[model samples]
Target chain A: MATDDAGESLAEVGEFAVIERLVAGRRQPDAVAVGPGDDAAVLRAADGRTVVSTDMLVQDRHFRLDWSTPHQVGRKSIAQNAADVEAMGARATAFVVAFGAPADTSADLALELADGMWHEAGLLGAGIIGGDLVSAPQWVISVTVLGDLDGREPVRRTGARPGDTVAVCGELGRSAAGYALWHNGIERFDGLLGRHLVPEPPYGQGRVAADAGATAMTDVSDGLLADLGHIADGSGVGIGLRTDALSADRDALAEAAAALDVDPMAWVLGGGEDHALVATFPQAPPNGWTPIGRVLDGPPRVLVDDAAWQGNPGWQSFD
Target chain B: MATDDAGESLAEVGEFAVIERLVAGRRQPDAVAVGPGDDAAVLRAADGRTVVSTDMLVQDRHFRLDWSTPHQVGRKSIAQNAADVEAMGARATAFVVAFGAPADTSADLALELADGMWHEAGLLGAGIIGGDLVSAPQWVISVTVLGDLDGREPVRRTGARPGDTVAVCGELGRSAAGYALWHNGIERFDGLLGRHLVPEPPYGQGRVAADAGATAMTDVSDGLLADLGHIADGSGVGIGLRTDALSADRDALAEAAAALDVDPMAWVLGGGEDHALVATFPQAPPNGWTPIGRVLDGPPRVLVDDAAWQGNPGWQSFD
Candidate 1:
C-alpha cells in the first residue's frame, strides 16, 4: 500500500522534479551567492582563497543503513567533510553533495537525508549550495566542502616546530567505542552508539586555534596517534603524547571499554572518527583547548609517553 | 592459487594502504599548488571568482559496467562536469573527484579509471588535484569542477531577449541515438556507441559565445528542446527552431537512425549528452557557432518551425 500504484521510481519522478523536491524551501547562508538549479553555484571566497576538500561515504562500508537512519547518514557525511575543511583552520562556507541511491528508495528517506544535511551544515553557518542525485545500486554520498580562511593564513600540518605545544579541542574515541559496541551487539552505551551514528565535530575551534597563533592543525578523523603521525610526517618532526593529559579522554570511555574488554587507552590513542581538532601552538592554547603533548625535533614519529605504541595504528580503506 | 592469497578484498588492503597504492607515482599538473596527501588541495584561482559544479554518475543507472569500461566511465564523468563549467563561459581549472567502488574491484581497474580521468583532464589543461576513495556496493564517481571566468561576466541562462539569435556549437542528438542503438542491440554504429561512452563537449566555445556578446547559454546535456526550454523559461522568452538549419546534424545521424528504424530529427531535436554549446546572441553568431533558432515572446516554450514538437523531450534522472 505504501508503494505507488503506478510503480513510479526515481526515474519516473525525473531528475529535475527530484531536484525541485530536494531543493525546495532550503535556506541558504549569506556566503552562497547562488544555490542549485544553475549550471554551477557561485560562492564568495572572502579571504581571496577557498579551501576545498572532499570525502565519499558508501553504504555498508562507511555506514550501514540497517544501523543508521538516513538522517544520521546525511549528518555523518557532512560532518566528516566539514571536519576536513575545519582542519585547515578555515570556516566552511558551503557544501556540494552528490548522492546515489537505488530508484526503489523511498522519496521520504531522501528528503530526510537532505534535512539532515541542512541541519548539520547550519551549525557552521554554511549552506548546501549545490548537489547531484542519481540512482545507484546502493547509497553513496560524496561531499565537497569549500571554506574561507577569513584573511588568515591557512594552518597546515607541516607548520609544527619543535617546542610547540600540541593541544586538542573536543572529545575523542567515543565513535570508535560505539563502533565496537555496535559490532559486538552490545547496546549498553546509548550515547556512544549515537556518537557512532553521527559524530559531533569540534565546531569553530579551528579558527580559534588559528587566531591563537597555532602553527599546525588537523582533525582526528583517523585515530589520535595515526592522525598525529600525519602531522609528524608532514612537519618532519617527532610527536610525544603525555598520557596524563589524555587520562580524561580515556576515563570518558572507560565504561564502554570495560564492557568490550578493551583498553580505554587504546580507544583514545587508536580509535577514529571523533573529528576533534588538534593543533600545535607556540604560545598558550585558546580558551577551549587542552594541551596534550609537545612537538619534538625530527625523526617523524608518534610516541606514547616517549615510547612507541604497539597497538593497532588505525583504519585503512583497503582493510 | 587465488585462495592462497587469502582472497584479499578492500577490507584486507585497509583504507590507508589502498589509498597509498592508488596515489603512488601519479604526476600532478603545475596548477595543483598542493596535491593529494593534504587535508585539502590548494589551487590558484587566478580570477577573483571560481565557477563550481558537480555531477554524480551511478553504476547501472547512469552507465552499465557491462556496457562501459571503467576508463570510458571516468572520461564520461569528467566530460559532463567540465561541460557545466563550460556552460558558465569559464574554463575548468581543476577537478576534485570522489570515487566509490566495491572492495573486490581490481586495483588495476581503479588505476585505469584514474588514468582515464587524467587523460580527459589533460585535454583542457586542467589538473586532478584531490580526491577521496572508499568502498561501496557499486561504482559511484562524483566530480566537482572549479573554473575561472578570467574576469568575464558569466553568461547566465536568464539573459536572453526576444530578438536574440539561438545558436549552437558542436553536434547534437548523437548520444541519444547511440543510447537507442545500444539499447536495441544495434551493433553497427561504433562511433555513436563510443560517443555515448565519452561525449565531446564543445570546449572553449562558451568563452567564444561570451565574447560574441551572447545573452544566455547552456550545454546540451539534456535534449536540445528541453535544454532550450530551460533557457526560454529562465530568460522569460520562447525559442523557435528552424528545421532547415539543423539538417546537417540530422543528416549526420540519418544512416544510423535508418538502421534503427528511428527518426533522425527526433535524435537531433530531443537527444541529449552531446554537450553542445547552445546560446542566444544579439547579432551574427560567433565564428564557431551555427545559427539554428531565434528567441520569441514568452509563455516560455521551445518550438520547431512555429509548431509544438511531438518527439521525446529528453532524458531525466528519475525516468
Candidate 2:
C-alpha cells in the first residue's frame, strides 16, 4: 500500500480506478468460483443450503467517523453481519459490501476501509468477494454475508423450551461500557474504549453450541435482556436471569462504571454490540459456555432475579 | 393493503412492529427454508452454487423523493441488484434489504416500499426473505440478491471472441430519455417519465442468452457504450455497433429527444439504467433479440459505425 498522494479524493481518482486499487492483490477464498470484476460473484455452497443476512451502518447513527477510524468502521460492519449468520449455526464464507461516501473523501480512506474489512474477514477464513462504491452525503456501509450450514439444522430463537439451561459464550457489556467511556471523553480504560469501536465475537462457538444440542440461540446485538426477550417471546417461555451468574461481566466494567457514577450491572444487562452467542440447552452446557439463566414455563417475558428490569431495556433503532 | 394510520411515523410504531407489518402475510418462495423473524435466512441452492450481487441507492443521489414515490424507489433498488444477478446467467431466488431512513418517516411509506419490493420479486417468483430497518438522516436502501445458477455455467464478460454477433434483448435509452423529459419538467411523455423512476430490466433473458450459446454478457447499467466497452475490454476484442440496426430504439425516443432538442441516438448510446441484456453470440441470436453490432479482432474498444461518437460517453458515479 502506497500513500504517495494522500490528498487525492475518490472523485479525482475516479470510481473504476479506486475500485481497482481496493481489489488489487487480494486473494479470494477457494469457495469463490468467480470473484471481483464480474457482474456477480459465484460462491460454492457444498451443503446445498446458504445462510444469508444483511446489516447497514450509517455515519452518525451507527458510528461517528471521529470516534472510529475507517478501518474500525469496516471491521465493525463485517463483524456485526457475520454474527447474525453465526447465530444461525452457520459458517460465514463470503461477503458483498455496498459503500456510500462523500465524493471529496480521500480514496486512501476507502482503501483503508477495505483493508480493515479484509482483516476481519480473514479471521474467519472468509473472503470479501464483491462490493459497490458510490457517492453520498455521508459515509454508509452495508454488508451482506453468505454462510454455509454444513448439513446442520439452523438454530432458531423459537426452539427454546421450559427446563432448558440458558448459557452464553463470549464477552458481555464490553461494547456498552466502551461506548459510555468514549461518550464521557474519558481517556482511561483503553480496552473498553477500543471494544466500543470494534467488537470481538466468539466466532466458532456458534457451531459448538449447535452441535451440543442447544435448543435455541441468538446473538446479542440489541442488549442482553432485549435479545433474550425475543427468544423468550418466540418460544412462549419465560426467562429468569441470575445476577450472581453474571457477576464476572459486571466486575470487569466496575472501574469504568465507578468513574462515570453509573451502575455496572446496567451495562451487563442492557448494553449491546458485544455479539456474544446466547443459547438454551436441554442439559448441562458444553465447554466454553457459562450457564447464566433458566427457561421456565410461564408467559413470555424476561425477569432479572424473578422481577422486571427497572433500567433502560435496550437499544432502540428510532429512540 | 390498508393505510389506516397515515399519520404515524416509524418512531411511533417502533422498529420491531414496523418490521412485522412489512413481513406479515408475505409468501416466501419454496426455496427459502427459513425467512424473516429469524436471525438470518436460509435459502436452498439446488445447484450447489449461489450467485450474489449488491447495490446501494442514496437519497438525493441515486433518486429524489419529490420526483419518485417510496414504492418506485423500492422497485428501482431491487431491479438494479436483480439485474446484476441476471447478467451472470442465474435465476434470482431471494433478496435481503437493509434500509435507513429518518425516524419521523411514515411507517405506512415503509410498508409501501416493501410492497413495491414484493411486487418486483413476485415477477420472478422470488421472495424478500429478510431486512434491517434503522434511522438515518435521509433514505438509504441497500439490496443484496441471491441467485441459483441451476447447473449452468455463468456467462462472463471475458468470453466473447472475434467475429461474434453482438445482440441485445430489452429496450435501450428509455430511462435516459425519460430522465431528460423529467429534468426539463416536460411531463407529456408519462411513460418515459415513469420509466426514469423505475426501470424494467429484461428478466429471465440472461438465462436465455446463456442457453443460446452467448459468449459474453452484461446488463446496461452504465449506458450502452460504457457497458459494451466492458465486454470489449474484458474479451480483448473490438465492438462496432451499427446505428442503422438500432433505428427502432432511436425512433421510439425521437419524440422525446426532439422535445428536449437533443439527439435520440445519444440517449440510446450513452444512457444507462435500462438494464437491457447485451451479449455476443457465435450465431444468430434467439427470438426476441436484435442484432446490433459485431465483434472484431483488434484492441479492445467500442465504435459506432466504424468511428467514435463525440457525445456524453455514459454516467459516472462520482460525476
Number of the predicted model whose lDDT against the real structure is largest: 2
Q: Which residue pairs collide, candidate 2? A: none
Tens digits of per-residue lDDT for model 1, A96-215: 999887777667777778999999999988889898888677778889988877777778898999999999999988999999999999978899999999999988889889999999
**Chain B structural similarity (TM-score) per candidate:** 0.95, 0.97
What is the C-alpha DockQ of each candidate? 0.65, 0.89
Stretches off by above 4 angstroms in model 1 are A1-12, B1-14, B21-31
lDDT of each: 0.85, 0.93
Residue lDDT tens for model 2, A191-214? 999999999999988899999998
Against the hidden reference, what TM-scores do the models get?
0.94, 0.98
Cα lDDT over the full model 2:
0.93
Q: Write the per-residue lDDT of candidate 1 for residues B1-319, one digit (tens) a residue.
A: 1112234455566666666776787777665656778788776665656678899987777888778887888889899999998888889888899987777776666767888888898899987878988767677789999887888888889999998999999999889989999999989889999999899998999999888898999999888999998998888899999999999999989999999888899999999889998999999998989999999996899989999999898877666
Task: Return the TM-score for chain B, candidate 1.
Answer: 0.95
- lDDT per residue (tens digit) for residues B1-319 in model 2: 1123367899999999999999999999999999999899999999999999999999988988778888998899889889998899899999999999888888988988899999999988999999899988888999999999999999999999999999999999999998888789997989889998999998999999999999999999999999999999889999999999999999999999999899999999999999999999999999989999999999999999999878887987899
lDDT of 1 at B229: 88
